[model samples]
Target: MPSATYASRRSELETYFDRTAVEAWARLTSDAPVSRIRATVRAGREAMRAELLSWLPQDLSGRRILDAGCGTGAFSLEAARRGAEVVAVDVSPTLIGLARARAADPGLPGRLDFRVGDMLDAALGRFDHVVAMDSLIHYRSGDIVRALAQLAARTDRSLLFTVAPRTPLLTLMHAVGRLFPRGDRAPAIEPVAEGSLRRRIAREAALAPLAVARSRRIARGFYLSQALELARR
Candidate 1:
């Protein structure tokens, strides 16, 4: 039950990813001696992994799980390793391909499924858990409610995600950075406030806020605020 605007936004995002995903992956995997790209990705994923593992229920053996916006398969792969039937979806073909290749590795083969699709349009079926880490920031302010509804519809148990804290200073920084000639590619540009975020989530889905962890600066320029919520449906 996504709105027309939501669908259109999803399409635009998919198109952007289709155009840039391969190049993004290439940069991530580049052989440049000065590059810390892969290490940064791994460290960020590890932090997210720890948070998710700590909040999730035990005895998830054989449960169905959906990883929405599953960039590079970090959370999705971990769920598969925990014996969940995992379907990982991302708008980027390159990211999905990388995830598939990672799944084909000896340890994770046949345990995960990766697909190039919008989280808003994918028929994800009923999942015991849904994860969207550091992904919702891409949504425009008005679209957050619809996006949360779409995500909640795909799951019956729990949903976990992270957002950049909505602070006046952070907002000002994003605005100023965007105006700078050389700050266009800066990492700390997107953030959402918790109050507005919670209101949107509540409007779109029957949900109970479980926990909100303090913002943790994970890498050179990225900061994350972890939230664990239960689907009340």
Candidate 2:
């Protein structure tokens, strides 16, 4: 079962995405040459790409993949373009709708499946690879472990994700930012410490660390860490 806080936050995130999807779609589609547009969009997700690629097996040519919290289907589209069957899910209906529209416009509706669903839901089946990037930070400290366990359980190969690192300076900055009005700044989600995150991964089962990269360059002033874990199972 999902916690009340998790559900509430998910609702808030969905609302935000619904309001911004149109603008996001316009921006994502502005560049000429779909490949160029994809590269530009992926520039913001390079850290995620690097870490996720490190954990995946060398050959993914016909394997099925699950992209949890696949906002806008950037990674899912990339994987599908690489020859993998992809099922991309997100809690936001608007984002999934936009993804579906993009796929259809390119005549790739058959290659990708986008759904609106929660990560904690087990109805989604196991896959060769499962990725959740920049999504785990929405959960409070205790919920992360459960989320990671659920992700691992749904994947036979690997689970890849990124989290905002919990450093003292970063924590202080978040605290200060929260004291101001909402319109003045974005609310920063509290990040988990590296040690605590490692412990959570351990609780799920031993996870071999595959790679870690900083996302500072992609998004301005954001101190985030991308991590890949190969599930022991």
Candidate 2 ranges with C-alpha deviation above 4 Å = 20-44, 105-110, 182-187, 204-223
Q: What overall lDDT, based on C-alpha atoms, would model 2 receive against the true structure?
A: 0.66
Candidate 1 residue lDDT tens string, 109-172: 3268787777756466777777777666655555665666666666667777666667776678
Maximum-lDDT candidate: 2
lDDT per residue as tens, model 2, 21-125: 546544553343435545555455664565576556555676788888887777787777666778899887877877777666364432687889886678878
| CA lDDT of each prediction against the hidden true structure | 0.63, 0.66
Candidate no. 1 TM-score? 0.76
- Candidate 2 at residue 175, lDDT? 86
Instruction: Please name the candidate that would achieve the greatest TM-score relative to the true structure.
Output: 2
Model 1 / residue 28 / CA error / Å: 4.0
The TM-score between candidate 2 and the true structure equals 0.77
Which regions in candidate 1 have their CA more than 4 angstroms from the true location? 1-5, 26-42, 106-110, 180-190, 203-220, 231-233
RMSD (CA, Å), each prediction: 4.1, 5.0
